[model samples]
Target chain A: MKIDKSLLTGSTTMLILKLLEQSDMYGYQMIEELEKRSQNVFTLKAGTLYPILHTLEQEGRIESYTKEIPSKRPRKYYMITKNGRKLLDEKKAEWQFYATAVNQVLGGEGYVGV
Target chain B: MSECNLLVKEFLNITCEEIKAKRVHKQIVNELSDHIEEQTQYYIKQGFDELTATKKALEQMGNPTIVGKELNKAHQPKTEWSIIVLTFTLVIIGGFIQYFVSRANSYNSHAFFRFLIYAPIGLIAFFCAYFFDYTIIKIYSKLLYSALFISTIIGFVFINRINGTYLYVYYSAILFIPIFAGIVYSLREKGYFGIILCGILYGGVAILCLFSVRTIAFLLLSISCLAILTFAINKGYFKCNKRIGLSIIYTPIFLILILSVYYILSAGHRRERFATMFNPENDPMGAGYLSLLIRELVGNSQPFGLSQLKGSLANMKAELILPAYNTDFILTFVFARFGYIFGVIIIALFIVFLARIFTSVLKQKNKFGVLISFSACLAITIQFALYTLSNLGIIATFSVTLPFISYGGLGFITNMLLIGIVLSVYRNSNIIMESL
Candidate 1:
């Protein structure tokens, strides 16, 4: 499925922060992991991912450090900051509220009552 | 596979071409290259042919220009806004002062409008310098140094000597400091050859200033060079004892030679300036007249100042009193009209502005940025101090524009340009810190 950029735009940083909450990951690893977890519902271009990563790093919500993997290459690994974790929790709550509103408007009140 | 490698380089090159930070470029290139290599290997191990693996890896990385633009957005050099906003404020206030002072005179509205034009032009000059890529100095250090050198020598023919002071042309000499710093930094690996070449270029300018009558330029240039060398030493550029010792020996000796020449050239009114600085009585009617009156007026003007009196600012101007009040003696207009509080506020802002400059310099990881920023900061600080002291009748020898505050032409532009370079350095400096 082709995911519109707008669909991912608002929550991309949140997704990144949540993924990073599990373990520190480099660019290629995060891209692959997101593809696997989402079951290919979202195919993020590498171009789109970097600016979001950079902006997150600049905002102090994430920090990157280069580590050399043996027989491979030096890769920049990013980890979520304490602030990023707090932000992720808030974003999660907001997403839940947003999802509920949309579901109700779309006649899915059956699940809500149950 | 070789073709694939070329493809990787070309893609990364296009992706990062817009990004100017040396460290960021290398970092991104390495990251992208490694990812491509891994992807290529993965495809090959999956039974794809080498050509197919390479092609697939390149395709998956995405479009170069789009990626480059995205990366550029992140890496866009941040202009130091506090300085920009503060400088703009000061320029506006300076325009106000000029307008009010000019309007104070009954018939003359000329200076008021002239200042209106100069303010915007000065700001544009600043932005131009700020927006210009500062790395050009590093990339073409030798070329920049050579161009500034030729200009300084050529500067002599166009000296704008007004009221017994050579103020023009030599202002270009200030450009020498940063360009030379860029040289030393770029050629730092070349060891003694670089240091000697740097010294020779500096010595040439210092020597020119030594013989010329532009004492302000001579003083500003020498002091700025001292600041750059000190910063380089502190930043570990001259880590070896030999370089440090050589600079120590060469710098003071060079300064002494300049000082001796200045002393020798300090004949006529120049020598009289030093002789009458403390005791205005010695040459009270001669060179000491203006300084003596300045001291008396400032002393009598209390907390608020002479402008508190009816039409005193206009009165001072219309009566054709206080020679050159708009030019060399500009601070008198500020203090006499606005009062001591305003004068001190102006001084405080200068200090704050300088602090902003130094703080930015401290953040620069690269030695070239640090050195160039330091040179500019030192030049402005020294000029500000000397100009303030001279305005207060402490030292009559130093006559310079009070940076963005005072009114002048080329001198003001040069100072603004220097500030712009500092801004450029600051704008480009943030991305190099690496964690162990």
Candidate 2:
């Protein structure tokens, strides 16, 4: 329930990369899908989302293009690059270790069984 | 149906390319058309109208700029370089004026010495203004104020040591200090308090130190009037019609009070000077002498002017009329030799020069531009007015010169620096416009 916003920045990038690994998506669709898949637990404002997208594009971790959709407005779609995939893999392993460590501490019943 | 399609087409045409305009257009058209058709069918099934539902659907789409913002997001950003260049150019002109005039007026010194003293100071002031981020200046407004305060104190203290009663002290402290403070305050991000304080401090010093109650009274009155105007603007008191009427009434009454005081404190010789102002026959051998001589020079001239340095009135040895002809009454001397037409031309040029500064200020967008433009304009204008009044024998003779045209080193340098600030404001205006 408690989340450090600064820590969430890296997590956000990891989430973006993993989502792009599945399929190319624009900013609005990515935000909508993230909220839906997480059961509405996560949401990103446009200001934060656009700046991250720009940073990722500048770093060549992702590429974007204008995509036209039938019966809907066209969107700026971003896809993960090879570098982004490698980065996502590294981040996933790190998150797994961090989650296990946190779970172990919370699950402890006694202090060294003294 | 045709009218609806035409509206959709016009909406699509107005949309920018940035926001996937064509795609959004297609989607809106399809969704709206489908909804309208469905609603119309539902209404028909209920035994109602078809056109009403379609009209209702179209009405809900709202204003276009809301949609246009989406398209604008993709547009490339560009910086306004013209404004930056213009601001930079004006600041440089100010520096050059200071340097060139100082060099021209330096007496018994080599040109190299003049350049050595003036060049580096001028360049540093110009470049600092050009390269320094204006935002940074704004953020550190307090530091700028303290620095200006210190410089004013220094200038005020040292001014008394310089030669010439009217030339060194009043010109430096009275005119220059407040103007410099205005420029500095304008450049910084702070409100007008620093400039207002500067004006008060300078005016205060002139009152306390100058030993002339008449001069002090007038200077204080001027500062107070300007301060009140500035305060009214800041407080938004000018918004009310009643406040405007009050200000109109208050100003002339204050001016009359200052004039009455000036007359009361004026010495016998000073009174004689005023008498001569109205009638040249009051005492031609004494107080009326300068006025009568000036009248002769102005009245005798043709269109172009008398030959340079050739008037009988100016050449004291040739006429045996007045003593100390070259210095305190220099304008009269210049007019006598050069003629009234030439005097008129010089005054016109000064007016044109000040007008140019006013024009530049009017064109500027920021508060800094407004304050600096007005302060510099007032400073130059007042000094020129004083010089003209003294020359025409309308006021007690004082030795202030017409800026740039006059032959004084310190006054000339100070004038150049003032011009530089005007240029700085002009340049700033250009930059702001370009950014827009």
Candidate 3:
């Protein structure tokens, strides 16, 4: 299914934070991994991924470090902080609540007895 | 193994062109270039030729202008509005205080008007310092330090004192302290030798002030400079043993403090002033006069409205007036004329102002920015503390002007310049790299 870009915009931060929550990652790695996990349904552009990562780092939610491997160009890696983890959990809860509410309104299987 | 292709280079250029902080352009370009290369490799392995794969990779990266605009938004220089607002509020309040001072002293009748003139000039100075990059101090630290040193010697040879106080030299010392932070930063790579070099620079200030016979300036300059050096050492910027660095930094301060105590004890007049500082009532007619007057004024002060003077204070009020009421003693004047509440509010305002400046210091990512902002903070903080103490008669009276509140042109302009440099440091905080 092709998701509208606008639909994914608001969730990009949460998705990026979710990826970092798994392990430290570089920009390309995060994009490739996100796409692979989504079965290639979500191909995050490099332009979109970096700005979110840089903004998160600025807010102290995550931090970046340069790791130089032998005979390879040094890569800038970002890891989630305690604050980033907390944010991710809240984002997860919020996303779940939001998805459940939308499904209920649409009269889907997510409907519950209120 | 190969050079970057022209198409990739052109795309990188367009992306980085949108980033206002040129300092971070290289890093961002490198990161983005790496992304494109990785994407290209993936495509090449999937059965595409190199040029076609690179083009495909670029297509996936999205438009350069949009990416660059977003990155620029992230790296934009942070202007600290809170500090700016607090500073101007204090400056306007200072204008009111100067007006009160003008009403009390005939010789200072023009003081308020002078401040009115200096205000716009101060604003210009503030913006000039704010917009200008302060890292240039790192490039010319040695030359600037030597220039200040030589100028101080020359100042001693010509204009030494105004009304028997070393005001000119003292204000110059206040201006030099912030610049000294840059010198300390420039020497960070020298290790222990850097500590020694800083010590020598500080020693030179002490010796210059000693020979020039300006003890107060020497005290203010040496103490504030030492604080910056100690801060740098503790932050491990000196790249030397912390304990050894601290010991090296403090040994001279300790020796100087002891020498000052001895010097004061050996002089009868200085000893009398020092002794009367403890008990102003003992010498109410002489050395304790100002202290006693300050205490009487503060003691009679009401909370909300103006306090009515009584007893000795009332009698003295009719016959004698406070000297420097417009300059150093403005805080006491505020308490005497307005209320303790007014004085407390002013002090609280200063506390907020200092807090704002300190917050900027914490936000700084670059070492040079940290040191510059911190040194400015230290200088202003010392002045504010000493001026308040002196005004309240808790310490012997000296010629220290309260930062942004005192009635002096040079002190006002110098303080604005310092705050400007701090704001400038904050403006470039995110853009500058951490390494240099």
Please report the candidate that would top DockQ against the real structure. Answer: 3
Candidate 3 Cα outliers beyond 4 Å, as residue runs: A1-7, A68-74, A102-114, B1-4, B162-165, B255-273, B304-307, B310-320, B433-436
Per-residue accuracy of model 2 over B1-436 as CA lDDT, tens digit each: 5765565455434543334423234433343344334444545677655555444433433334444453334322223344334433433433443344334344422434454555456555544544343333334544554564465457556656434232344443434433443444443333344434434544554543354223522453365336434543454433434454345445655886799769855778677656665776877777566666665654555455352334553433211343343334545644554466656766666666666766765654445445555566566667778877767666555456455444444555565555555566554442322110
Q: Give candidate 1's error at residue B23 in angstroms.
A: 10
Of the true interface contacts, each candidate retains a share of: 0.69, 0.00, 0.75
**Candidates sorted by DockQ, descending order?**
3, 1, 2
Deviation in angstroms for B13 in model 1? 7.9
Please provide, for model 3 over B1-436, each residue's C-alpha lDDT reduced to its tens digit, 9 standing for 90 to 100. 3343988999999999999888899899889988998999999999998989999999999999999999998898887899999998899899988886677667778988899999888889899999887888888988888888888778766875665555577767887887789889999967889999988887787777666566667778877898899889989998889999899877876897899899999999888878887888879898788888787777777785555677655634411467777777888878877779999999999998899899888877678889999998888888898889888878777777787888888888889999999899888877775632
TM-score of 1: 0.70
Q: Rate residue B304 of model 1 by lDDT.
A: 64
DockQ of each: 0.42, 0.01, 0.58
**How does each model score on lDDT?**
0.73, 0.52, 0.84
Question: Ten consecutive residues with minimal summed lDDT in candidate 2 chain B?
Answer: B427-436
Off by over 4 Å in 2: A1-114, B1-167, B174-203, B206-209, B212-280, B304-331, B392-396, B430-436
RMSD of 3: 3.1
On residues A1-114, what C-alpha lDDT tens digit does candidate 2 reach at each position?
Answer: 644557566688888888899999866567668878877666644335544665565445777665676874554567888878888899999999998888778777663343
Q: Rank order by lDDT, top first? A: 3, 1, 2
State each candidate's chain A TM-score. 0.87, 0.82, 0.91
- What are the root-mean-square deviations of the candidates from the true structure over C-alphas? 7.2, 23.7, 3.1
